[model samples]
Target chain A: MNYNWNWGVLFEEQYLNWLISGFGWTISVALSAWCIAIVIGSLVGVGKTVPNKIVRGICATYVEIFRNVPLLVQMFIWYFAVPEMLPEDWGRWMKRDLPNPEFVTAVVALGLYTASRIAEQVRAGIETVPPGLSAAATAHGLSTAQTYRYVLLPISFRIIVPPLTSEFLTVFKNSSLALTIGLLELTAQSQQIAEYTFQGFEAFTAATVIYVCIALVATILMQVLEKYTRIPGYVGKEA
Target chain B: MTDFDFNVIWSSLPFLWQGLQLSLLLTLLSIIGGIVLGTLLALARLSGIAPLAIVAATYVNLIRSVPLILVIFWFYFLVPLALGRPIGGFYSALIAFVLFEAAYYSEIMRAGIQSVKRGQVHAGQSTGLSYWQIQRYVVLPQAFRNMVPILVTQGIILFQDTSLVFVVSLRDFMTASSIVARTEGRLVEMYLFAALVYFVICFSGSMLVRSLKSRMAT
Candidate 1:
């Protein structure tokens, strides 16, 4: 094992800039996708629990279709086929005029994919809340909507904060798949550095460290959130 | 837009099947390897030996925190040089997946092991069973049975993740489909077909898991 070791190459201005911007993109994409997942997933999740069988069926179907497919394939469909499926002018606009198409496609693909998973979590969280609470709220003359808004969601959200943390970390890790569509996030940037410097070992090692750092910080922050929000008597049970 | 061509895909089935075989091979190999190593790590974490527990915990945490694709790259590039020899992409990716999945499997198995009744171990100890005997005869059988559904779920995830090996230019199903798509200029057809194949397999696999779960519940 006589290969040259050049750990210092990562600090070069060119590689450093790539890593920084890539890191920025990765964080931005993951954060934006997390927002989308939580918002849509919550709605779809609540929809799944509604009494109307049709709404529940539709929401379940959405989760199945999105969750069953591979993220890479979904990304490909979004980046390539989706644009072509639109009307000609809109399709052309998307392909030619849309700003940061790869980033947009990546975010949309990752968001919708993750939303299905989060929807399951959200559904589990909602279902985990005691039935008597909603019953009591109804008995107090609160409408179903108000009961959920004031009573059910608050508690369920607290219960789900831990699993949501895992999903949050997952969104960040899955962002690395965006490189398949040419968004130069951290993984892609590392690959580019490796290609230029022929130092795949160091480049990937650095990227791995960065990912571990970011994920650990997110985990710690989520742990703190979980600890503070944890209902003393209700912790540690699986939903 | 061009008419969708069924003929190209039909004619390419043999090549596609070869790719599928490789994908399955990777999945099967890695699942076995991961479970074997994962059980060891899980045991180490539960072994009540501080250094072993700390080392296992760190390894699992470090592996779990990073994107698996990065691990594939690290193994693909680093291991060969460390061994003072070059290895092929497929072998490197296989090793990478095994090592990466072990962390996740360990976590699942750890939870499963903990779920077993503590009294059962006490009972075995009272019968004069050695510690290793208690684990082997009393704890692990129950734990593994409890974890089968979860292990299957993880296996499904492993199948989906094997697509990531396309990054290494492995001739897995995804890479093969993309190759055909590029050469034949049937990008949409190829990709959509590929997605459908994945969806059908995974969706049915999950359905089976759901039924198995219900059976377990009953």
Candidate 2:
């Protein structure tokens, strides 16, 4: 069989547009879900840190449910089953009232699943803030909440920045899973492009390059962020 | 008025059993293929040759960064388009899944190799064992023992990851559930049945890995 290589196929306009649009969808999912992850993970992390039995139990159960289940199954449940369980008008509202129900379900599923994992990271980060700082703040007569805001949180966020970057990469990679529910993310778009051009290698190689670039950019930005927050030898510079 | 009919489970027993057989075969074949390929890839990454190392690293990283669904799609959709050879769905899915699982396992094994003490190598050399023999005798046994837990954890994760095959429309447990749901119009029961299937296989695998880990530590 004489095989022809088609490296130049993606330079064509239609294929280029397919790649660009797929990325637009992927980045939107990553950013939207990142917002949700930050908020939800922080809350659950704080709850995990709380001394109260009920609060810790609630946080643990949340983590267990979201963490143990496969994200694809969670997406399936969110897209198909959860809507059916909603109140009649509510289900209709979710199905019809939302623009891009696929996007919403993808965002919610990816966000919730990733948030559980991040909650564990956040809890570890928050816990790593030296106990002395918060104790000192409380001794200085700050309220408990004030102690957390003034002393604990800032340190923890800085400590967690590198790991937080990793979580971001994972969320970005996992956003590809959304394509199964028919979100036109990078994976889905690459498939569609390949279908049209039969340039499978070119489309997939482009997608791989895109993912590597994102991960590389993330690593670079994370390094910059680490520098901005630098207190030399603060955590002994190991991380 | 509302109860899960155990009888629906009984009637659907044959279908679920079929899914179980397929799921077991898929997992087993992929695990075997993955173990062999992943171990080699792991060794390749640790090999002294620069180009070989780069190739191994790139394979793992590229495969890992993309979703397994996409990998499966490549085989399921594009193989026919790209190659004149027509591969059946199950074997195609099996091949893709094995490749995907190998990337992660190989990554884990690479870490395992690095974690072995450098002194063990020198010691083995001093004892007059050849380099290949050193790896077989001194390095691999220790690395494998140290990595048993992680290998098993990866196994469980890979087992869960097998569910991604549904994207390629393979009739694994998840797809079987959908089929049962369609024919019997019992979505809830079918899913519950599927979940149970997953739980039993994964839970047992976890326990075995745990126990094996404890045994190896001794």
iRMSD in angstroms, per model: 1.3, 3.4
**Best candidate according to DockQ:** 1
lDDT of 2 by residue, A1-239 (tens): 33556988888888888889999998899889989999999889878987688999999878766765567677777886666666778878887898899999999999998899889988998888778888889789998688778887788877888788878877888898898788989988888887888777778778878888877787788889977876567764654
**C-alpha-based local distance difference test score of model 2:** 0.80
**Chain B TM-score, all predictions listed:** 0.97, 0.90
For all predictions, the C-alpha RMSD in Å is 1.7, 3.4
For B102-154, candidate 2 gives per-residue lDDT tens digits of 98889777888888999999999899999789879988888887888888777
Q: What tens-digit string does per-residue lDDT give for candidate 1 at B110-150?
A: 99999999999999999999988998999999999899989
Which 10-residue span in candidate 1 chain B carries the lowest summed lDDT?
B1-10
Candidate 1: residue pairs that collide: none
Q: Write the per-residue lDDT of candidate 1 for residues A1-103, one digit (tens) a residue.
A: 7778899999999999999999999999999988899999999999899888999999999998898889999999999887766778888999999999999
**DockQ for each numbered candidate:** 0.72, 0.33
Model 1: reference contacts kept, as a fraction: 0.69
Q: How high is the lDDT of residue B81 in model 1?
A: 79
- The regions of model 1 sitting more than 4 angstroms off are A236-239
Best prediction by lDDT: 1
